[model samples]
Target: MRFADIVIPDTSATRGALEVATAYCSPALLNHSVRAYLWAAAYAGMNGIAFDAELLYVSSMLHDIGLVKEFDSHTVPFEEAGGHLAWVFAAGAGWPVERRVRASEVIVRHMWDKVDLAEDPEGHLLELSTALDISGRRPEDFPAGLRAEVLERYPRLGLGEEFIACFRDQAERKPDSLAATFVRGGVADRIRANALDG
Candidate 1:
């Protein structure tokens, strides 16, 4: 069955951000990032939640950017680092401060165990989308064959293995960072229990 097609927002700024994010992030991270957007946007559509496609796209696309060594920090959490990096990228792309900050909130809070939906619904959708992509939470929610189509366009390419390693690296190097905290706080178990294996 053909699921509703997912539309990508492709303004000039969005295209530029994609290029920079692609240059910095690994293939798996990049694919996962884009898939996160697709999942979030699709979920929003299914749920009838109106959203800012541009902001969501940018935030989701750059969510894992802190993992890139060029922006890596020894002390700061990757989510926050990536948030700051995305903020800068957004600002450079001519986003107003308020909107850029909003986008950064989505990136910064994506790793949170639970995001406050009342405060930022976009971020909330993003958080849920990543959870769906990474761990397959509420598998019944997806439209039939939607996941297969997304994976075909942006294949996981062993993203699960790659991500777990990245999480381990964070746990080892920055024990106090969010990645480290989540990794130590049963993320591995979460991933294992929610394996994406078909």
Candidate 2:
């Protein structure tokens, strides 16, 4: 249950992000976030795409932090709110402005079903990884047994239902929020019918 003690990349930024994210996010979300990072990184490696692992680690781990009370917002989309929080963390951690900006972009854009790959390959990785996590979309893309290992290491623990509720809450609180848009557009239903239980 102690994730911070787990071994990860030795980079200071990723080391800090893992610690901060593990401490800040709920258990279910922590599991999901780490898996997202793993999936995204794995995809990058498989496809010969170059990426900053530190940025992906920070972006994916903190991507859902906006759903937490400390960063939740009525006016901003949860994605953007999380991006802003990630930006703050990155800045305080002394990330260069460009790097932090890319982190924010990667975090904020995951909500879109499609990402402009040329604009942000990192964002596209997030889209693919989150889509897989949230809905089991394109599960075949990940190598066999990878998902099993991730699940074993970090169980879902009702992450599906929890995220659905968070979206529902966001919908209720702000009809104009992205969650509300998804709800009104029937996307929420599709997301819930996804393979996961959380």
Candidate 3:
């Protein structure tokens, strides 16, 4: 789907924020972001998380606005980028600080499997959203240690052994790759934020 296809309820602030973000990044990623929003929404609904679908859509739509300002991993860590983006968009659009803060948090922690939700709500939500997006797919590119860690923490996630094997073998064979790990990490934190939030 085109980035333009991503719509948050009734042309809200998120729509304007996403328009600004699309001007900077590839539309392809925005498409993926839409998928992420769907995943998060479904997961939240199924698991009884008190999430607002429209708000989640809006947060996910503008989650990566930091890329618009050319913020890097080193200078603007992913955890902080979300909050920063919300603030920037809010400032640009004359939005309130509270709204900006919520959006910014979503962007900052969109990649958060390794984070603890008690400490970081935004990261947890992103993690949950990511996990739901790739629910049945195996991380065939994750390191052995990382795979073990995930399984240990979420044994009840019920991922099949075959899927785990596929991810482990592929990841081990293809060393020096960061795609699987980073992608998983992004969702991990979001999941925690969304699932573990009170």
| Comparison by lDDT, 1 against 3, better one | 1
| lDDT digits (tens) for residues 157-192 of candidate 1 | 777777888888988998877778778777776766
Candidate 1: segments with Cα more than 4 A from true spot: 1-4, 193-195
The per-residue C-alpha lDDT of model 1 at residue 157 equals 78
In the range 1-198, model 2's lDDT, one tens digit per residue, is 123322345577777778878887899988999889888877777777777777888888889888888889878888989999888889988988988899999998998879987788889999899988886788777765666667778889888778888888999998887678877777666666765443
Model 3, C-alpha of 38: deviation from truth (Å): 1.1
> Which pairs in model 2 have colliding backbones?
158-198, 159-198, 160-198, 161-198
Q: For this target, which candidate reaches the highest TM-score against the unseen true structure?
A: 1
Candidate 3 Cα lDDT to native: 0.49
Ranking by lDDT: 1, 2, 3
lDDT of 3 by residue, 56-103 (tens): 666677665433336423343433555666677667767577766666
Candidate 1, residue 80: Cα displacement in angstroms equals 0.6
